[model samples]
Target: MTSDGDDTTVLSTEEGWQTIQATIHDARGAMYTAGSTAILLMWAGIISIAYLAQYAISTFASDFAEQYPWFPGPLWAALTLPGVIGSMTIGHRAGRSLSTGAAMQSVGIRVFLYWMAVVTAAGLLPGAAGLWNETRAETIPYVLVGVIALGHVLFGILHRPVIAVFGLGYAVSFYVPHYIFEGIAPAVSGIAMLALLAATFVWVHRTGEW
Candidate 1:
């Protein structure tokens, strides 16, 4: 950044990078809020459909578990599919250029979806196949932190502040799941999530970047 009386100086490469990051940080907030809303809508639709499916089975169905076990109810509530899609949509709109929006955001969001799809497929596999191996789910954060966290840094390398903000959301996703799923405690999990989000919100506000 340079200064000339009453005239803004053009940013050099490094300063331009900072400017891009600030823009992305603003964009991420919009994306998350939009994504959350989309996911809630998806939850409503999924629950409604799942309930109807169960009703049909109850009314005229037979051996439902033998054929249609592993209802998508809990999966619907998990909210990853819709959330990831919604986030991706926002990311498309958030892109700095077509390259970032089309190539990067699209691929990143699809990576998340692919991950979930694979997990679901595994559950559908023959033999002792289901997602509830406590030990397996326990490793989710580690896998994500190792892979997704690195993905964040690599893809968002140009946008430091944006990645930092998104990282907060990502980290909270990991920690909250442990309390909510492993501990089977919602109250504690909710508080932890809210507290961390609030702190991040305050920090963002103080920074006045977004």
Candidate 2:
């Protein structure tokens, strides 16, 4: 009877440890989700605004574009800088709330490096192959959107299905507009992305999955 009791106590202790670990895992996931969701929403707004602005400039400010052919590059850099800073801030705050904050931050840094590598490859490979030029400048937006969509899809496949759906929505938004309403593709894609992101925000809150 004493041996059986000892065995039961050991089993209970193991179960308790397992439960504690699961709770910690869930908490980490929730924190990461909260940080990531905010980052995604912020980027969605920034990117959509950039797209809309591009459309407006190209359509209503032809003189400006002609006078300053380099304006778009500067504009994008200006707009993107804030998002980058904001993302880092959000991630840092989220990390601080976790017990393993340093480790979590390290992981985040590694993930960021992975994305940088992906973006670098995307740019370098095309440039090296002489696939990008002034003649195909208009395709730059499509390529950027494609890269973002692909990243989202891969992220979803590795982490969550919902993200993959967002990726699909982004692809469809741009592609459908490109083929069917080429003149307004930028506007349509921007609006679609904003709408999709808004819906995702609502869904996450309602489901409490994040």
Candidate 3:
């Protein structure tokens, strides 16, 4: 009878541990979903505004562009700076709330560093390949779009399948505008991305699948 009781106690303890582990797993998943939602929404707003501003500058502010000669580059950096800060802030807070907080923080840092490397490589490739001429300048935006889309796809494959879907959608939106409506490609792509991001945000909230 004592041996049987001991066996029962061991099973109960094991079950309790499993339950605790499941709870932690669920909490971490929730935190990740919430953080990703906020980050995606933030980027949606930033990208939309940045693209619109680029269109306005290129179309209506030629004088300013000529005066600066480096108008959009600085503008984009300025616009995205907030998103970078916000992402780090969100990740930090999310990490603090989880049992695996340190590991979560490490993952966030690694992800940020990965993106930094990707963007740096993209920026350097044209120069390294001797393709940084005036004509090639026109393709820079398209190249950036491709790079961003690729990043999204890769990130999604690694972390979230839905993000991969959004990435493909984003690429298609930009490509359609560029090919079919060259005159307003930037504006159209910006609006389309905004809509897509917004829709994804809504779906995630509604389904609670993130």
Candidate 4:
């Protein structure tokens, strides 16, 4: 006893739900794409800055250590400051562009804050020790590797298994450079970390999975 109008209404309702579902699917994909692209670009920028700074130091500051022993500290700050700012800006814009769930974004923000706190504590420990003693600066890079590895593990907990596996691999691979290049362990560790991050970013870009 159903009329034609009732059949038409049912079809329209089904079509509406399908459209909504499709839109949600597309939005999720967009969010993922944006995140991957942002991380890729941000890490690439950091890598470029590191290499470029090394070039500048070697070319222009060959005798800097003799005259100004504190030169490397400022140089490192110069190199890191931009990378940090640029990465945050890139991530913010990418996340803003896609209409993702607010609850999910809040969770991500909280996790990121926790990661930052952990890393900050790691960095501050060496800094405090350095203030107390003279030779502690040399340990900063090695400590950073540990901190970064921990952050990646945190990401795996909050995000996925792949990052956790990468974290484990990185933690293991990090010690090689420290032991091999004792005099320049920090620089070597930085370069090695940049390479690993670049490789990870490339894989993410190619697969579109994080």
Candidate 5:
């Protein structure tokens, strides 16, 4: 039913599609598996501990600080230092082991850099907010939730649907509480994020997905 030209065009299109699909498969397969998962879990654990420690200091340290003047600063450094060192080590190892095509490697490195930027911005927001006022400080949690949701959506578009769906759920879980009660948003968001990361670690570990 088709002419020679039409058949040729169809064949070319199919070949193009096949090439794209193959690249996608290879890219996914090349992602760091156990290494990425371990890094994620370690970071999640560290963040969780830091958040809990911060909460404890804010809520209870007033009384304890008199008796233990050196506690808060030392504790925060202890919690944060290991995470920094571990993440760098794991990321270096993963980079060394990566066997993806140049294009995929470039994409992965950009994504990693973007995330690092996000983290740096998130870290600075609190200090910036302090310079403004308490109300501005309160918005940090909401901004972080939005950023996380957006990050997930970007991942979905670029990588996987599962991450996108998880991001949607994460955004919802934290945002809903803000509408209900603002007082608990930071704590709730931090806890929820850590829980989601924990669950994601388990899922990726079981599935061997990145």
Candidate 6:
């Protein structure tokens, strides 16, 4: 009963609404992405600054020890560990889905592993000096194993057990030369950690888990 021109007009109106809805949806998605990225980057940066400050203060004491026959305190700079896992886990769970929650759970497991194997041990470092000097090969391996274990757990190829094994291997292989070799250890560790994170990001994107 409708004229041809009337049908055409009705179809055009429907298409316009569909287009508008799509545009709005796209805009919302972009906004969320931008906002999340900014917040995480800022949070991570702040955490990094805090970690560095602690490291610097720790360095001051250790340096004094160097001149006065002192030694690094029982602390090996622990501030960096908390925010590394804490902020990312918080960011992931903010408005994400069940899978992200699960990944973060695994991350938490790794962190617990670090705490048991590293932070607690860091507290007991003073006692270790009595057993062996820092310059000895024995102590270096222990430090590397603990710190590398932390890296593997916090930044894994997946939220699976394989990453933990790899991390353990890395810890075993770390030598003092690497730790003090022109300050490359820190950079290398950072990159390796990022590799795991990069993989996680890919997984999140491909699966739409984020």
Could you give candidate 3's per-residue lDDT for residues 30-136 as a string of tens digits?
Answer: 54544554555565567667777877887898788667655666777798788778877765565554445577666555545555555556556655755555345
Model 3 poorest 10 in a row by lDDT: 1-10
Candidate 6 residue pairs in clash (backbone atoms < 3 Å): none
- Angstrom error of the Cα, residue 168, model 5: value is 2.7
Each prediction's Cα RMSD?
9.6, 4.2, 4.8, 6.5, 6.1, 11.7
My TM-score estimates for the predictions, one after another, are: 0.36, 0.77, 0.74, 0.61, 0.61, 0.34
TM-score for model 4? 0.61
lDDT of 4 by residue, 49-103 (tens): 5544644565468686446545545765676666556545555555665546674
- For each candidate in the order shown, give its overall lDDT on alpha carbons: 0.43, 0.67, 0.68, 0.57, 0.59, 0.43
Q: Candidate 1 — what's its lDDT?
A: 0.43
- Candidate closest to the true structure, highest lDDT: 3
Model 4 clash pairs are none
- Write model 5 residue lDDT over 1-210, tens digit each, in one string: 356657643447778899999997865645523144454456446655665565566567757755665454466458757766675666555655674456544544544554555555655665565622433533444554466467656755665666677667667766775677666765776677677777877887789765
Write out the backbone clash pairs for model 3: none
Residue 102 CA displacement from its true place in model 6, Å: 15
Give per-residue lDDT, candidate 2, residue 170: 71
Model 6 misses residue 195 by how many Å? Answer: 6.8
TM-score top scorer: 2
RMSD (CA, Å), candidate 3 to true, equals 4.8
What candidate 5 gets wrong by more than 4 Å, as runs, is 1-21, 28-46, 64-84, 100-111, 126-139, 181-189
